[model samples]
Target: MGAALHLAHAGQPAPGERHRTKGKGGSGGETFADFARQVYGDQRATPLARELLLAFGYATMVAHSEAERDVHDVWSTARKAMGATRTGRRWRLDEAIADDAPRYVSSKDREHRVCEAPRLRPHPDGPDDFRNVRGICGSLADWEHYALEKQLGTGWYKYHWFCKRHLDHLARVREQLREPNERAPQPVPNRGGLLPAYFESDWLGTYRHRLDSPTWEPPVYGISADDWPTPGVEPVAPRARLRLAALDGTLLVEADRGARR
Candidate 1:
């Protein structure tokens, strides 16, 4: 747990220091470090929420490791910055992209909206091509038929999207299928030595193995082959390597390089 070990004391600002910044007062002015601290302290946030936020905070820290200011596109930035390391850029292929959420909320079709313009599909041969993968507009699918998967488990997700009426019926059916004595697992906070296990076992473990291998092909949605660091070719940055070390279970190293206060 290199830098995430003692996150509470590492280069943190004083009690009143965070509020002095010029921006939206309170949380809006807060840095990723400040936001992480608040999430850790908030008793109301669920364990799942805490885990998500902390992981995001760690990703943010790694993304802007060379910069002092926070970035707006933390996810995209992190994907690019960590592309060369053993972490690879793909987070989770099964998780539904939040950017695609708004379309599902509207009663009317959003396909014709000025903002929802048609985009080119990835090249058939590969994402990387001499044409830069640019192509003609494939027929846009209708907004009404657009569906997204609901993740159920590892390598598993709902096969089809359901309407509200069908979802209500399915909810009842699912409840009936559960045993009377069955109980859901209680969620635990990913802190006080628990985070390292969860991070290593689930979060980083997902893509770390693929990145460590040599024969990996660049996925259309993930980092390109050019971004992959070749052995003895391009040296991996210290920040890129720090994320993997931070989640090590047996290590007790000092956490010096952390997000700015």
Candidate 2:
């Protein structure tokens, strides 16, 4: 803040400058730590510190991590900082996007303005004897098929309700048909309280025999003395003779070292 302003006032080597001075503000290629030290004469990387310097018109050399992305973007940051939406409450993505009631008034072909039809019309017959008829949208063929199906459940016709139902069914069917064969990775269950992870290659084959084939289980290291170290135990040997399972089998492995031999 003060440092950024001081640099600006000093006409100091601000970032993106053509000057060639050492230990100056915005010299070049400063990470968050580097930038903090250069700007504030301190080594702490604070969000407030970054915001203050950037707000005073400076670009950061560092990229924001993916986790912080949802609540922060260039557009929102700039707008909120400039006091553009001070009085009005800020609308998030959810608030900005929404469903609304169907439009009752719209231009008909942009030429004629069509008003809605009256819901109630005067009946020539007595009001008590008036019909409460509802709409049925179907062609003669549809009517014939529907009537036949109604009689026997024997025809290939769709009721209006069937359109939406059948559409939903079709969407599900399409998704089922389009799904790829690739399976999602399951958790490794961390039998030893380790991260569940995977590599794409066949290095796992080295441990496969112990995991899958019949073997006497070791009590301390389970079935994997090849990898995991036992709890509260340490080995004195150097790591020189350790054999990593090769994904590429073409490379000839070195002999077990003389110490082990």
Candidate 3:
């Protein structure tokens, strides 16, 4: 039997089944499965809360691939540099700012308040790097967090922060990144007379249309039958053709006169 079939025969517990195993923190800790059950079993736990707990459990239990591990390592390094913990900790903006100068001032009152912002990614799929994280004003952050919780139908808020403006900007950016087919089709302008006769003209007009033809006329200024160059009949200029190599080296294709046919 295949390894997958053998593992299947081994009889692993269902997702909702209560079982204890090593947690994400390390070995011998409270198991994710048990933790998930505890969260689900609680009467006070909301549906969103249960889902969030379950997602965390699922993420922890799944083994990371080599590429995933590499990404995780980079994210870990960035988090460490920003003084963030594995279990999310709130960071004070005042600590990073100088006593004389503040990075941000309140738009409402123009007061310098010490904002205790949670170290969070701007969006769910945003990079784990510190550059993507924003530290909004304290009152604004609290209101935003509350609004998010209400919208999600959960008491627990995920570690993703954005003020109204930032949130709207991210939404617009995401919309722009969506596939062309996924986006709503834009209305095409009706330009009945704007198009040239060659484009909208009948078969006879298209076939008979020529630069020197008496029936043909220049649609735009600075263009006429006398200005149109005759194809194959005119003496063409011998221009040097250049080819670029993979390593940034350029090769002149028409270097040798004898090589040219």
Candidate 4:
């Protein structure tokens, strides 16, 4: 699928441009294509990673072309739909998913399938927030959720919330489509579904870096130094004293620290 997409976007090579060429070893060294081939051909690189590298190379070579624009559009749409924004932005995962109507269609049958909300970051660091959530097919979601949960049980609540919200939204959409005297809305084909593969692969190591590094700054509300206690000299205790009073005709009374002390 990635290769097909790449080819579709890449179109044809320009006049006199070589699509593939052998690299020569020596002072001239390796060409960019040679380096790309070496990276893609490395036995250590996963299939998904290799494909991502190839896609990236193709995109770069065809920069500013329609292919690049299409690729950018797809990624941009996925990012927006997944709420993959920098922290401090309002979490709008539910809103974005509802608006986008993301679905997973079976490659064999082309039927819509149940989708799951997968987290981009499995926590201690990642919060139960929209920024970490991405929509994926049920199988992939289950696998990812189980793997993460097995390793660390954190962040499940965020996944649960996202799934519930997404399901409810889908139900509402379905109901609306079934309403009498209303034309049923056409099913919007899934574009974001492929994004799960990218997320799962942690393609180009960028997502991995994002997960490992603490880039997100959660918003701090109502926090101020004024709310904290100030340090100063210790308060002095009140001293007891004797009091004397005179009223009418030289009447006098004296009070001491007796019982109070």
Candidate 5:
């Protein structure tokens, strides 16, 4: 879906240049986009970050102009996975029977038979295979974690939490879909489900009460459904607020700075 489509549903005022919040006070800083990269690890986060800034009545920040070495190392991974194999005087990548898992071993060896494209050639190591690839995504170590978890996490059986997180990651990634990544269109939106939307607002309100009354701040912004306390689950004060200020287009920024410590 294009931003235009999203904007339609968002018939809310396009904040644009009209509601500029003040620059960060008392905290020395970077530009909004740069700060977004610092905290979220991506400079492209600038636009979304700008949205977040305005929600709270804060101005955009100044950020580093140069891309820092990405926190995740990607190069070493590329070399390992891309190396080809030789069989009967012909060389090809291994048949990696791919699926969407960070680890590729599902009993569901269902490769893309749609056009039979994957089966025709040896499987090149996927970009997610950080064990060898590099840059902008997946460090070698992150890929290695996938590989290691494949071996150790119940013989590559994924955790329920893994599936949940995968769904959220998939959504955010889809929101960023202008560029392609290893992620594919999901069969379904299997993340914690729409159930969280109901409690998310209320839970956050109480969480903020805990923060500010002592005075207020969130333990963390944007609580995942999994992290919520259940009925009779006592609420604990959150550590700090998340950057975004509102939901349903009514949220306002009441705090600043990315981290307290």
Candidate 6:
């Protein structure tokens, strides 16, 4: 998606130059294509990072053009399963598996068979193992968690799959909701739920780095559906402000920074 975005805007002039070329006639300075080529095509002048970006951009364009059918099938299926029906209700990813939780799980099982387990580690070592033996869109229904959960007879087993990036995002959201004094939950061997250690370790590394940075910032505690207090559960000050911020695409980073100041 990032590659696609980069490619989408690669042909346009830079923000500063856009005004200059707005009304230019033929042969007016450098054409937009010429400028794009100079900025994105020149191997000798482009930095290694930029060259790699251009390569990705080209690859993205090619993939979209050639794999249109496969992309459509995968995304359409996932979208429909996520409760993207004609209803006026819009799904909030921050809430995750929003609306009817049971229905969402059922749809995942019946319609989309993938791993939506937020707590599972997609890759322990590195990016190479990002996707399991099954390709990117492959189902993880036969994974250990699912099999174990089936044998144990318990709550909804997550049989949906998400890309590594989204799994990382969910991990961060979970960390943000964690109380400062909270202790990490130890997972029982072969248990079918979240393993907190994997996410905690990653968050701790980032937290330590943030503490050592020149511009230190406090952690953002954004709540998710799991953190939401239920009736007769625990009564707590609702974190609706954080959810609203996430919906508006800000995530309250600036607001939190100002509050700290």
Candidate that would win on TM-score: 5
- What global local distance difference test value does model 1 have? 0.32
Q: Give the TM-score comparing model 5 with the true structure, all chains together.
A: 0.21
Candidate 2 collision pairs: none
Winner on lDDT (3 vs 6): 6
TM-score of 6: 0.15
- Candidate 6 lDDT, tens digit per residue, 1-261? 011111112232232332122234433223334334633532222143243223322322222212122333322333333343346364321123111111112223544445444434455444565344333433344322231122122122323344444555445544543442143222112210010110111222232232334343221221112232222433222211110011122111112112111
lDDT by residue (83-131, candidate 1, tens digit) is 3324644443112111111111212334331112123456465656422
lDDT of 2 at 80: 40
lDDT of 4 by residue, 110-140 (tens): 2322244443335343454333344342332
> 122 in model 3: Cα distance from truth in Å?
61
Tens digit per residue, CA lDDT, model 5, 163-259: 2223444344344432432233212111221112211223344333323332332223123322333234333332222222332222222222221
The whole-model lDDT of each prediction reads 0.32, 0.24, 0.27, 0.28, 0.24, 0.27
Residue 196 in model 3: shift from native, Å? 66
- Model 5 misplacement above 4 A: 1-27, 31-34, 39-239, 242-249, 255-261
Error of 3 at 137 (Å): 47
Query: Clashing residue pairs, candidate 1?
Result: none
Model 4 residue 125 lDDT score: 34
In model 5, the Cα lDDT at residue 152 comes to 24
The true-versus-predicted C-alpha distance at residue 212 of model 4, in Å, is 9.0
- Winner by lDDT: 1
* Model 3 lDDT tens row, 195-247: 11101112123222311233542322112111122223332222211111111
**Ordered list by TM-score, greatest first:** 5, 1, 4, 3, 6, 2
lDDT of 3: 0.27
**What clash count goes with each model?**
0, 0, 0, 0, 28, 6
Q: What is the TM-score of each candidate against the true structure?
A: 0.19, 0.15, 0.16, 0.19, 0.21, 0.15
